[model samples]
Target: MGKKSGKQNKLIPESHFRLTHPSVSPASPIVDTHTHLASTFELYRHKYPAGDYTTVFDFVRGLYVPAGVQDIVDVWCEAPVRPLWREFADSAVTEEGRRDLWGGMGYWFVMGVHPHQASEYTDAVEADILEAMAHPRCVGWGEMGLDYHYDNSPRPVQQEVFARQLRCAVRLGKPLTIHTREAEEDTERILKAEVPKDHKIHIHCFTDSPAFAQRLLDWFPNLYIGITGVITYSTNTDTSTTVRNMFAVPASSPPPRLRIVLETDAPYMVPAPIYADPAFVAPDAKGKKLPICHSGMVPWTAGFVADLLPRGEGEGEGAEGWDAARVMTVARENARAVYGV
Candidate 1:
C-alpha cells in the first residue's frame, strides 16, 4: 500500500536550496514525528532524482537531510493504507529498499482508522489494525480521534471507534496520536475516561486555544502538541494555540515547559518558506503540480518555531532562548521518547 510513484520533483542539490543558512554545522537534526512519508515523497514528484539514490528515497536523502532533518514517523491513518504500510515497512529493511525507500534515513510508523472513516471501522478492521501494530516497524496507534469540524463520520460512530481504538492502543501498550478537531470537550472526556494514566499521546497539528493546550498538558504529563508548518503561517485559519504555548515560558521565565514536537503533515501543511501560492507554480512532468509539502521543509519550520519561542533566560542549552538548534534537539529527543525509538 505504500508504493509511491509520480514525476514530481526537482533535480537540485543541497547547495542550490535557499531554505537554510550555511553556518550551522550538523545543526540539531530534526525528527518529523508525524508525516505521510510515502505520500509526501510522491507529492513532490521531483522532475529527476536529486542525486544517485533511487527515486523513492530522493525526497528524504536529497531534501530533508540537507535541511537538517534526521528521522520521521509515518502515520498510516486510514484503514486501506495498512497493506501499503506493510509493503513500505517491508521495503525499508532490504539493501535495495534501503537505497530506494530510505537512502539511509531512519523512520518508524503508527497506523489506525481515522475518524473520517469511522463508519468503516469494525471488529475485523480492529483485529487487522492490532495485527499490523504487531509489526516491528509499528510503534504507536493513531491519528485516530474525532474530527467534528467536518463530521465526515457520524459523531456517534466516531466516538465509538475512537474509544474502541483507544482501548486497542492501551491493550497493545503502544503510544497514541489522537486527531481531535472541533470536539475538544468530547475528546477530553474520552481521553480522560478511555485512556489510562501515563499513556503517551500526541494531538496532531493542534490549533486549539491556549487554555485547551494547558488543560490537556496538565492532565497528561506525557502528552505532546504536534506542531507543524501551520505555525509559520501568518494567518492561520485554525488559530493554533501552539503559537501561544511557544512563548509561554518567557525567555525571562523558567525551563522549557511544554512537550512540543514538529511535523509536516506533509502533502498538506507546507511551511511558508517553501509553500508557494497557486500562481507561483507549474505542473510536474506528469501534467500534475503536486502540493508543496515534505519533511525537507522541516528546517524552515524549526527556524520559524524558534523565532516564536521565548528566549528564557540562562546561559546555554536548557535556558530556553530563540535557539533553533536547541528546539530541534528537544524535538528529536521528544520523538524518540514518544515512539521509544
Candidate 2:
C-alpha cells in the first residue's frame, strides 16, 4: 500500500504463532497442515533450542518419523523463507543419501509473505510470490494476515497486503493460509468482505476466542482450524478456552463443523512432552529444550488433541487410543479436503 517495509521473521531469524486446544497417536497418520522448514541457528539457539540436526531434511527424518508424523506442509511465511523451503525439498531429492522427509510422511508447502513483514512487501516480491503460486509443490498462499500484537508492520499496510494476497490466491487457483493474532475483529471482517467463505482457507495456528472460532467456522464452511503445541501448556488461557468450549464441549452451540487440522509450526514450538517434559529438558536447562518443533511432533499434538475431544464418539469407547486415532483421522481428512494433495 505504502513504501515497502522490512523485518525478518525472528523464527526464520531467517522467517514464522498459537492454537486454541490441541493431538496424534501412532494409530492414525496425520497431516501437519502448517509448519516451517526455513531455519537459522545462531539467533534463537540460546533462548529456544529447536535442535542441532544436520539439515532441515535430517531434522525431519530424525525427529518427525519417530514422533509418528506422516505428512507435513512446510510453510514459508516470506519471500526469503519461500525459496529456502523449496531448496530443502530439492536437496533431499538430489543429494546422495539424503534423508527422506518421513517415509509415508510426504512433504508439501505453502508460500507467502507474513503480516509481520507486511511493510516489506514490494511489487517484485509480490510477483515472485505469485510465480511461486504455480509451482506444483506450492499448494496455497499464506502464513499472511494481521498481527496487531506486534504491529511490526503498520495496520494499514498489513490490511492492504493481506487483501492483495487474497486476490492473488484466487487468481492462482489456490487456497490461502492465514495468521491472525490479537486482531480478531479486523481479521473476521476482512475475510468476510474479501475472501469467499467457501474458498479453501486455513487459519493456521488458530488461537482466538470461542466465539471467534465459532464465527469463523460459521462464516467459512470450508475453513479449518490449525491446532498446535501451545495448547499442551496451561498458560495459554485464550487457546485453551477456545478449544474446550468451542469445539470440545460445544455447550453453547455445536462445535464448528469445519474440522480441525494439526501442525507443528516447527522450529518454534514443539509438542507437549517434548515441550514440557523434564526428560527432554536438561536438568541445567536455561530454556525449553526443543522449542524448535518438527513434523515428528505432529502425532503427539494430534494425540493430545484427540484426548481433549468429547470421548465416545468414535468406536471402541474407553479403548486406549481409539478416540485419539479418530481425532487424527479427522485432521488428516480435513487437510486433504483443503489441500487436495
Candidate 3:
C-alpha cells in the first residue's frame, strides 16, 4: 500500500489499485503475455513526477510484483531497438540476477519491427534483432504485422516487411507474435502463405471481427488470441463479441476449449472496473482516473472476461464455469505452451 490520503476511500499512486479478485494471489499468479515494460516505466515516472521509483525494475517490483504477476513478455518492436532491452534481458539470465533485478518475477521478450516502423526497417535493424534472438530471454520474433489503421508505413512496405520478418522467424523456428489492425485480408493472406499452419503464434491484443478471429483459429491450431483490458471497454464491441462467440456453446455441450491469453498492453487499456472500485478514489483534480495501466490490473480484465463466459448445466459444482482464477491459470499455461517462458 502507498501513503494514504486524508480521505477514507481515496488511494494514492504509490498504493496502486487494490487487488480485489479473490483468485488473483501469489499462489495463483498470472502472466502478462504482451506489454511494453520500458515504456510503462517511463509513463509511471511521468505520472508520479515526485515518486521514488528509480528504475524500470524498481517500478515493476513495486507495482506489478505485488499484483501477483509471475511473468511478463515485454515487446521490443521498434526499428531502432531500445538499448535498455539488453539490460532487462541480461538481468533474467540467472536466478540470482532475476531475484536481485526483477524481484524473482520472470521477464521474457519478443523482438520485431512494428508495422508503424516498417518504413525504417533496414539491414542494420534486422542485424540488431537477429543478435537479440540469441539472447536467453528472447522467446519469440514478432509483433511484426500490417497495420492499415494508421497506415504509418506505406502499404507495400508494410506487406514486404511483414513477409520478410515472417520468413526469418519461420526459418529460425521461433514462435511468432503478430500485430494486425484493419489489414485483415492482407494479414490472413500473408500469414497463410508465409507461416506454417503448425507454427506457434500469439495474436497480441486481438480486437478484430469475430469472423476474422474464427478463421485464424480454424487455420492455426497452436494460435491463441490475446485478451487485454480493451475487452472491457464498451466501445470495443469486437473483443467482447470475439470472446462471447468462443463461449457460445450449447448448454448440453461441455465448456468450450478456450484458446485465449491475457495481457495488459500497458501503459494503455486500463480496465473499466478499476474506476468503479471504491478504493479508486484518487482521481486527478480534473476528475481523470488512473492514467496508466500495468500488469497488476490484469485481474480486472480477467473478471470482465469471466462475465462473458456462459454457465451451462455442468458448470457450477461438478464443473466450474469460467472464473477469474481459472482464467489466470489457463492463460498462464497457454503462455508457457506458446512462449515456453
Clash pairs, candidate 3, are 2-15
Candidate 1 residue-wise lDDT, 1-341, digit = tens: 22333222332322333244332345577678889876765544543334343555555666666655667788888765557777777766666766556766676789898999999997788777878787877889988999999999999999999998999899888999989888889999999998876989888888876777778887987888888888877777443455545445555754445478888898787677543423224332222332456676676677776666556654434454666667677777788778876
lDDT of 2 by residue, 1-341 (tens): 13322211122221111112234455476667887656522223443355355454555554566556667787777754445665655544422524444344566778889999998888888877777676666789888999998999999999998988888887666888999999999999888888876898888887777789878977888888788988777766666566555344434654334267878676666666543543334333424243356555665566666666555452332223435567677678888889975
In candidate 3, stretches whose alpha carbon ends up further than 4 angstroms from where it belongs are 1-12, 17-20, 249-255, 282-287, 312-319
Clashes of each: 11, 17, 1
Off by over 4 Å in 1: 1-27, 46-54, 94-101, 237-243, 246-254, 275-290, 312-320
Once superposed on the true structure, which residue ranges of model 2 sit more than 4 Å away at CA? 1-27, 40-52, 79-82, 89-104, 246-258, 275-288, 313-322
On a 0 to 100 scale, what is the lDDT of residue 334 in model 1?
80
Using TM-score as the measure, what is the rank order of every candidate, best first? Answer: 3, 1, 2
Question: What is the C-alpha lDDT profile of model 3 across 1-341, one tens digit per residue?
Answer: 34443442332555554354567876558799999998888987876666778888788777778778899999999889888889989989999988988898999999999999999999999999999999999999988998989999999999999999999999999999999999999999999999999999999899889899989988998999999999988889998888777766678865566688899999999898777766665443224467678888888888888788765434532146777887788788889989997
Question: Looking at model 1, which ten-residue stretch has the lowest summed lDDT?
Answer: 6-15
Give candidate 2's TM-score. Answer: 0.78
The positional error of residue 45 in candidate 1, measured at the CA in angstroms, is 3.8
Highest-scoring model, TM-score: 3
Error of 3 at 312 (Å): 4.3
For each candidate in the order shown, give its overall lDDT on alpha carbons. Answer: 0.72, 0.67, 0.85
